[model samples]
Target: MTSGGRIEITGLTKRFGSFVAVDDLTFTVEPGRITGFLGPNGAGKTTTLRMLLGLVSPTSGSATIDGTAYQDLADPLGTVGAALEATNFHPGRSGRDHLRVLATAAGIPIARVDEMLEMTGIPAFARRRAGTYSLGMRQRLALAAALLGDPGVLILDEPANGLDPEGIHWLRGFLRHLSTDQHKTILVSSHLLQEVEQTVDDVVIIANGVLVKQGAMADMRGGGGAVVRTPDPARLSEALAGRGLTATPGSDGELVVGTEDLRLVGEAAHEAGLPVWQLSRKAADLEELFLELTSGTNRNLGPGPTEGVA
Candidate 1:
């Protein structure tokens, strides 16, 4: 069985004419973990993926899998699988035929085609023309083709774009199976913040082709603040502000303190002589962190779980 590889992007930069598509970006995708690649529109996420796949050349720096560049890999298809665009399949070709063609080109066994079809849950409609299939079905077909070689590293971009809720749920479970059960390295880029929040074990966020943050999902969530409900919300807010903590207002007269330290809130409330009815760690919010990281500049977002793959 093939083994997964760590993805290392080192000071990668891409230039199209005068505009910079990717800046001096660097990050890593750990093996056996699903890493979410997130960025706003025109943030050079596609460019970074293209460079990593060797589809586009980097103006400077390099992207490597297990220290070997994609072009230099002994078995490219068997080592790295990517589905950047699900719509790249031929409209007239059957889904099974598409995988077969890819298998033949990659020198993979034709038997793997059926296996992938079954794995992707497209065996029932495998013979149907890709043009006749819905967007979600096409996504499944594309995924089947990508898995034909059983590559250790999987890269997907916006794979959930056309998926229904059920499809998305299945995708989450499928990716998890690949990562945990098979120990495959998966890097998925998607705009669905909520879905990304739920799916990925780690995240790499970029803005203007620059890396803004990258770390474990748990660390990101763990850095989140705590919620509190005090009778004197303003006084509590002022008290927290004096300690260099921001207290944002949440719904139903709740105070969202900017620290994960529950004891800090308790002590502050106690000192203020305020009756603290409730105080607890707020829910993990990847969206809020993402927005805050990408808002003003592409610079690193202050301090927190922004350190992982150095």
Candidate 2:
């Protein structure tokens, strides 16, 4: 299979009447890694994915896979696989029948149906009617259908929505395997920051339909802040300042050191004869950062005829 290429979005914008759904969004998803596309509800995540897949046209700018728009790709299905929802299957059709129908439509061999069922770990329920399948099973079936073409890139929107802890664990490992072992480009859109935090290599965060931050997970988690507790807060703060370190008072009367190097703080405190009671490095958590970024944005609760009903 051809290796996946870069996916680029440039100045992508979408508007509906007076409301702008997506506003001047731009980012690149490189191959061979899982990039989390994260934002709170009503942050235009679904709209952005829709544009990327050519289901919704952007008002301005463009989204392209391998330097070509999704619709313009020569072999779109073979090059990109997407699982935006698991509810698209026919209720009456068996899971196997559902895949077989799609396979036939895609000109894929019938043998690939079994391959995908096994690959998705849903072979045991392949003959069951899709309507009777659990949410997790439906998700697995949807994923199998997406992989029917053996696409180089995978775009999944909330793929873990209905999965249990075990299923979520399985999905994390499966996605990493696809990126590291198979070299497939994967973009997973999710509002669950904690889940995505553990799964993705990099992240693109947005809020209020605008870019908030995008970078490697390491970079975001780096620059650890140290929390220090001492009997004499003034003395410790002075010592840290003497060493060119800014020490601010934390909420609980602890000193917050601005640097990740705890050794430096400890040394400064020891030299000043201020006995340290407690010291711990504060590693940044993605969920914390996400909440900080999108704190006041309107949350998209659900689809309804009236807004803010529930």
Q: Which candidate leads the pack in TM-score?
A: 2
lDDT of 1 by residue, 1-310 (tens): 5558999999997766556677898999998899999888667787889889998889999999999999999989889989888888889999889888888888888999999988888889988999999989988888887788889999998888789999999999999999998999999986556777889999998887788888888888886689999999999998888788899898899999988899988888898999999999987776887888877664332232221111
Q: Write the per-residue lDDT of candidate 2 for residues 226-257, one digit (tens) a residue.
A: 98999999999898898999998989999989
Off by over 4 Å in 2: 227-235, 244-255, 273-280, 296-310
**lDDT: which candidate is best?**
2
Off by over 4 Å in 1: 230-249, 267-277, 298-310
List the candidates' TM-scores in order.
0.87, 0.88
- CA lDDT, candidate 2, residue 18: 56
Whole-model lDDT per candidate: 0.85, 0.87
RMSD of each: 6.0, 3.7
- The Cα error of candidate 1 at residue 4, in Å, is 1.0
